[model samples]
Target: MIIDTKKLQKEVLENKKNHGFNTTDIEFELLRLYGETNELFEAWRKQDKENIDEELADVGIFLLGISEMLGSGLGEDITNKMKVNRKRIYKNRDK
Candidate 1:
């Protein structure tokens, strides 16, 4: 199935608002994302490739929620920046 990431992100934020997740809950989500990423890294280290993809997807979901809360389109912004940086940044760093 196709996913509309923007819509999904919006829904996440709306749900959080509706459920009244306070500042501490938001902070908890951020910490959860960090822990998920750590789990992904640990799975990678163990060469357990299967679970890593799911864990990383979990991280992406939380990150999208946080970014939406912050009024940011992180995926779009990052992709756009990478396009600009691909040539200049890599070339300069290689020098």
Candidate 2:
């Protein structure tokens, strides 16, 4: 099934609210992603690719959640930045 990231984020925040957690805030979500990325790095170092993938997904979910909460289109922003950087870094690498 295709997941609607915005709807899933809203649902997660609602569940957190029902449980007395303030997940509507972007900071909390960002901290969660930071922890998740650390875990993913650890798993990757241990050669646990499956767990790494799961943790990466968790990171992406939190990133999208925080971006939506903050009204930022981070996916597009990162893509545009990477495109410029790739051209500058890779296009002249042989020179």
Candidate 3:
């Protein structure tokens, strides 16, 4: 099944608006994203599949929020950036 990321992003925006959240600080969003990433990592370390899934969702939520806050099309940006990443050859990624 294909997930409609654009639709998901729109839904996130709507949800935020419903909750009376106004996008004010990009720095706060960045910090939230960082915290969510660490939560994902912690879930992985604990081998908690359920928590991992939830953390993954949180990561996506923050990412989409950040994109919307920055007034960029999240879906388009992801597609374009991934295209470039897919073509790039990388070595020593772990180094």
Candidate 4:
């Protein structure tokens, strides 16, 4: 499915407004994003597929909302970054 990030961003912001979530504080958003990532990590560590998916979506949702709050296009930024990455060379890191 094709995802419309602009529309999703707007919807995310609207949901935040409806739920009375923090919309103006970038720091708070970043902290929330960090927490979501930690949750995602915990889900992965537990090998819980269901919770893993939910936490992954939560991370993406926070990212979309933060992009909207910053007046940035998350989709466009990703596309552009991908293009740059494609042209770059990288070495595999040891695990």
Candidate 5:
């Protein structure tokens, strides 16, 4: 099923509120996102499939929460970025 990222972002914000989590600290969220990314890398290095997917979800949750805090539509941003990426050429592709 196709996920509704905008709805997910709203749910993340609501969950943060319900849990008394940081809803206004972008820097803290960024740091936590970095930590989550590290965890994802470690999981990949260990070839732990379950943990890998979990860590990835953690990273995505942080990102969606951050996007909510910043009042950005993550879905739209990703779609636009993908369009830009599709039009770009990598000079190092032959290397």
Candidate 6:
């Protein structure tokens, strides 16, 4: 099934509220995102598909939460960034 990221983000925010998480602490979330990224790396290195998927989800959760805190539409931001990146030219290795 195709996941609805906006719905997921909304649920994440609601859960954070239910758990009494300090939603304003973007710094702490950034650190947590970093840890999740490292976990993803380790999972990839170990070839653990389950943990890899879990960590990847965690990374996305933290990122969406951060975007929520910043009042940004994560979906829109991603689309806009991708649009800009699509026009970029990479350096040739043989140059």
TM-score of each: 0.69, 0.66, 0.83, 0.95, 0.95, 0.87
In order, what lDDT does every prediction score?
0.79, 0.75, 0.87, 0.98, 0.97, 0.87
Off by over 4 Å in 4: 92-95
Q: What's the candidate order when arranged by decreasing lDDT?
A: 4, 5, 6, 3, 1, 2
* Tens-digit lDDT string for candidate 2 (25-93): 777777778899999999999999899899988887777667667766655667789999877845555
lDDT tens digits by residue: candidate 1, 1-95: 86677887888777767988642366788888899999999989988888988888878878888888777887687788898887673434543
The lowest-lDDT stretch of 10 consecutive residues in candidate 2 is: 86-95
State residue 10's C-alpha deviation in candidate 6, in Å.
2.0
List runs of model 6 lying over 4 Å from the truth.
1-3, 92-95
lDDT of 5 by residue, 14-91 (tens): 999999999998999999999999999999999999999999999999999999999999999999999999999868
Angstrom error at residue 80, model 4: 0.2
TM-score of 1: 0.69
Cα-based lDDT at residue 11, candidate 1: 80
Candidate scoring better on TM-score of 1 and 3: 3
* True lDDT of residue 63, candidate 4: 100
The sequence of per-residue lDDT tens digits that candidate 3 reaches over residues 22-43 is 6668898799889999999999
Error of 1 at 58 (Å): 0.8
- Model 3 spans with C-alpha error above 4 angstroms: none
* Comparison by lDDT, 1 against 2, better one: 1
Name model 2 segments beyond 4 Å from true.
Answer: 1-22, 89-95
lDDT of 5 at 79: 97
What's the count of clashing pairs in each model shown?
Answer: 0, 0, 0, 0, 0, 0
Among these predictions, the greatest lDDT belongs to 4
Clashing pairs in 1: none
